[model samples]
Target: MSSISNRIEQISSSKPGAKDYINYLHSLSAAADLISYAKAIIQIPDGAIVARPVLAEFVSYTKGLADAREEVLIATLDVLKEKTIIFEEQEFLAREALAEVYEQKNEFTKAARVLQGMRLDSGQQHITDDQKVAVYVRIVRMLLEDEDDAGAETYLNKCALLIHKCNDPAQKVHFKLSQARIFDTRRKFLDATRKYYEMSLEEAVDADDRLQCLLAASKTAILSPAGPLRQRVLTALYKDERSVQLPTFKVLEQLYENRILDQEDVKQFAEMLEPHQLALMGDGVTVLHRAVLEHNLLAISRVFSCISFPRVAALLGMELTQAEDTIANMIIQGRLSGRIDQVSGFVYFDSEKSNLNVRQKALVRLDEVAERIAATSRDVRIY
Candidate 1:
């Protein structure tokens, strides 16, 4: 205990050329054992202020020298494993050093403790609110990426509290919007929608913030289940003074595609929309139709590939019977001219007209007509 206590005091005092001493210790065969000893200093009883400072000193010394990786690792382990009194002692700089080394080693829990230490030290003169917010957001995002939602949510709530302290109302709203978006990503759709709705209402009262809020609320509505909630959000969007430039078109087309609204509803929505909105709808429809054609064409094309027909159809979520019928119909229409391989049951598209019989030729002609219709529909911008 005396030797360990002396080493801790030497670390705390950081004598001249102290880095050399740490290197010398690292070179010792007993360096790992010394690290364990430093860890025990941190674990010493609560009223042991002298011991805590010594442990902190040792940590500081190790932090200043890269050769102290073993010591730093052991200190970090004490925080997680030994329930050492890091939080109460204000040994943040020591914890920060430990976190840096652990983070370099891809040890997230130790890195997270750096944030916790900062949180404990947050009211100190040096740690500003902005710095605290930055740390909270970083740690929360890391936890989120690791799928530790509970931990992330705790930090996010802390971030939200700090954001609420911002003097600018707009900045506060921005933070709230960000909070809502994070919740949305976690599939807490109702919470997201509620926050978005409140923001939209509040911002709509201010003409300058209205458009920004409309865009946010529109996105929230799109994610929500089709019901009064979505309708309410849409209604709020439409009521905004800048609603003319808002995203009504894409939302309507998306709703139509999802079968949440019918053709008559689409027509009504188009009529209610501005010219730019109508143009946007036309663009969405064109893209949708092209996607559908590509999906079908790609499915048919794959039948000629080495892949099994049923396997391709199953992947496309089409019934094997429907796939067969569709292929046969395409052959008859002359859009596709191919004989089904007897062994593989795969259709091979033929380029030569002479290769097609009378029924096949007629079918190919019909397919040409259908392709023309599809192309015309895709090219026309009715909006």
Candidate 2:
């Protein structure tokens, strides 16, 4: 310990050459003296020579030194692992430095793991709320970068618990953005759209960020199941004067107007959505395709009081059986106030009943369309 401790003092007081200090640390690392080296640094006094700043400088110096950079970081982390109870700042910085190495290498999940390795809830360290929030936010972002929403969510939950206590606007925005992203990835389009829309309205977030959030809002809104609840979010986005500038604005308008979305239109809008948003559902059709098909059926209901199954299938560009099934589902869910005349191969719509609360009254022959809309993925925007 005295060896490294005296060397740190020598370097700290004299500002020794980078080569000399780096070479010495490299030697210690090569000799497997990691524990001693780390302890020497942690053992430094806090009053005249604080552990926080000195540990930060030590970690900073090791970065980009090529051969021993990551090795030194890991060594420091190992030494401080169980001692975070006392050397919390040193351990945090050590882990952060190692995580940065992983980040630079594009190993996002590994970076997130290294960051979350800290025992934030152990209560042994005096880590402030802001510090904990910062760590949680970083872990969430890194996990998101890897497209691991479930993992990201675990950390975001920790942030949510303390977000109100956080004073930094940037961190708060990060927490909101991560939450919205998780909502989106999990196919909760309506909830995601609402969060993104809310973030867009925040002046605290810069214009580009706000614009991206608005675009995300519109995309999620378009992807949302065609329903009155989703329409509210779509309407709000379309009415946002600033939304007019977005390419997604037109799709949002179409969704708001309940107009049938064409294949070309869906294709264009699908271009902006994430792969998961376009992921195939159990029905062997993409989510966007499913949403568009249902939306078109809703449009059809508005125009025709009664439509033949063949005509509905032709209009929806799908098989007659699929059209019948889709319409039967809408009717049963009370999303469309209609009944299927299986014998006549036609669907009859009730304009008045369509306006009534779904649970207020069950339409005629509810069991005739016995197939219930599967609750396969409730994490989706619409329940």
Candidate 3:
């Protein structure tokens, strides 16, 4: 306690123009008591403005001494955080540098926790929106790396509120990538596929990075529930020339071509999937099971006009009751282009009707868009 008091008195009583106090800490560096001095200086009364230079000089002075660098930062932050009026700029710099140290050590949660403790998110904290988004993006990135989705999501939502206002295009890309990750983790494959594919097309992104995004799009498209919504993203990915480079390309190719997936094909694709992807769904079936069955059902309609329920069950490797129920559900959802015949033990295909239904849906969407535009125009005129 006396050493701390003497350190504060020295800084307070030193000549105003001379930064001898910084030199004083440097003198103690050889003695390895620099941190004790840094801690004491931060406690100076109304010394918020003086805090940044002391921390900055200490950071510079401790260069090459890795252990001392961390100690100096920790000492400065510990004392500064307790002060009612914090020195914001130095605090930001110290936390960021500390987070970098933890990140390099593969301590992702610690890195995120260090940044999450910053005051930048508060209304009173004076910082640009881009700056705020940058820190939030870093926090989200580390949280995701730690596989803490719930925590990542909490910070990601904060980023969303300010991301659009940000001028940094690079930050925007990072934000979008984080969003794709969150969506993928949550099993919202269709949305993830769209975001990934969209980012892959960006000219600003590096070629390797773009390809990685494209690969993610391909993988998620295969993982998505087979339906019109999934089909749209799949079609986009299949048409993208870069998707051919992905290991999942064969699966995407067969799925898009409506070719019946054989056991070998399914096995190859399953080998590439993550453990969560192979986990059982609520229906006592794996995600792969549902995707394969739904897709093969569509493929059957492409090959034969009609098929017996028993043969359908044999082709899909399912029982008669499950085959009937799956076909019925597909028909009800307007996914499969066929109707089931329980009495005749057959299913009938209607390719033309399915095309008509899709066209009708397109027109319905166009009508809704037009209505919204017209309503907007009316509101503008009233205003």
Candidate 4:
């Protein structure tokens, strides 16, 4: 640390006068060890002031130093921006710090306006490449926060261009990830999936940032459109993996119910689901479809736990009367082995059975009625 500090001092000393010294300090202050740089910055006095105008500049430059250390940077900037420390140079530095500090504080539009106004002034031409990148990133974040996705995309593209020009690999990766997110938000599915997939692979191979890489890969594969191409992509993704995280049972059921996946796939998907997810699948199906399946006595009891009779009837393309008669006949014929709720009209199935003469006879008659309806339907061809 001392060697680096001495080297910075040597470089700055070669350039005569205050402006060069301030520029040197600004550059050094953006180093990884911001606290040491900050302490070094505070040691430089400008004219009669206890600290130099560059001190605020340094603090504002490193405002995003790790979360815990950010407070010191923020506090330092606040002190420099105070009204009592007034000089043309000092005021300019203070305004620059104000824009940066406000951006870190997420006062985005205010920061943008400050930066925009500053750009109109000749003083803004002195800003560095790093400063422009930081400012534009804040603008992108602000636009995303406001749900102005197009604006966010424009700003992020600008940041990407700047970072690319600087040849900063780390920031390039970050900018690409941000671009992927923007595409995701815009529902540019193929673009998002491809970019995220590439980013994840690069991050993984470089072993630079594992968690972010894995997250990118997960999101990429999770939302990718399914077909032959998607299957090939998944095959590559899982080739060396020990296990894969499948989509939720609800999602699978929806795909199947909508004919996105076939019945065999739906059954296989259901078998893979956790019990709770399986239970939720009933509600995931169309109301009329679920009701029809339940009325035919084909639906599972676990599925019925999540659905009501009216919803089931709606699924089956039947009226409440039809549903009630179907369930009643099941009970009467000793097939349901359940009790009927008189109030809500819900049928509660149990393992119990009833032996009766009158109900059995009535159920036989009910079956005849159902067969008659089936025959009548078969006879008609409205189409």
Number of the top TM-score candidate = 3
Best by lDDT: 3
Instruction: Residues 314-353, candidate 1: write the lDDT tens digits.
Output: 6545567656765666556544446566487766665443
Question: Estimated TM-score per prediction?
Answer: 0.37, 0.81, 0.83, 0.40
lDDT of 2 by residue, 1-383 (tens): 56667877776566444444455655653424554666665654432135555556667766656656777788788767655677676677778888889898889899898997876777755788988899999999899888998889998998899999999899998899989999999999889999999999888999999999999988888888776677678778888899899987766777778788767777788788788988999989988888888888888888899999999998888998889888888767756677889999888887854455444445433643443434434445863
Judging by TM-score, tell me the better candidate of 3 and 4: 3
Compared with the true structure, model 3 gives a TM-score of 0.83
* After superposition, candidate 1 runs with Cα above 4 Å error: 1-90, 96-110, 113-139, 154-178, 193-220, 234-383
lDDT digits (tens) for residues 1-383 of candidate 4:
57545654675556445555456555553334454554444444333243454555554555445453345544544444433334234434545555666666777666655544334224523556666676666566666555567877877877876785654555566677767767766655456656766776774246445434444443444344433233344454454242133333333233223223334544554454223222333335432233234323423332454345686577655677766766666666544455578687676765313322456658878999999999999999987
The per-residue C-alpha lDDT of model 1 at residue 12 equals 51
lDDT accuracy of residue 72 in candidate 3: 66
**Model 1: worst 10 consecutive residues (lDDT sum):** 286-295
**What tens-digit string does per-residue lDDT give for candidate 3 at 200-251?**
9988799999999998888788888776677788888888887888988888
Off by over 4 Å in 2: 1-53, 64-68, 82-84, 352-354, 359-383
Name every residue pair that clashes in candidate 3: none
What C-alpha lDDT values do all the predictions have?
0.54, 0.78, 0.80, 0.51
TM-score of 4: 0.40
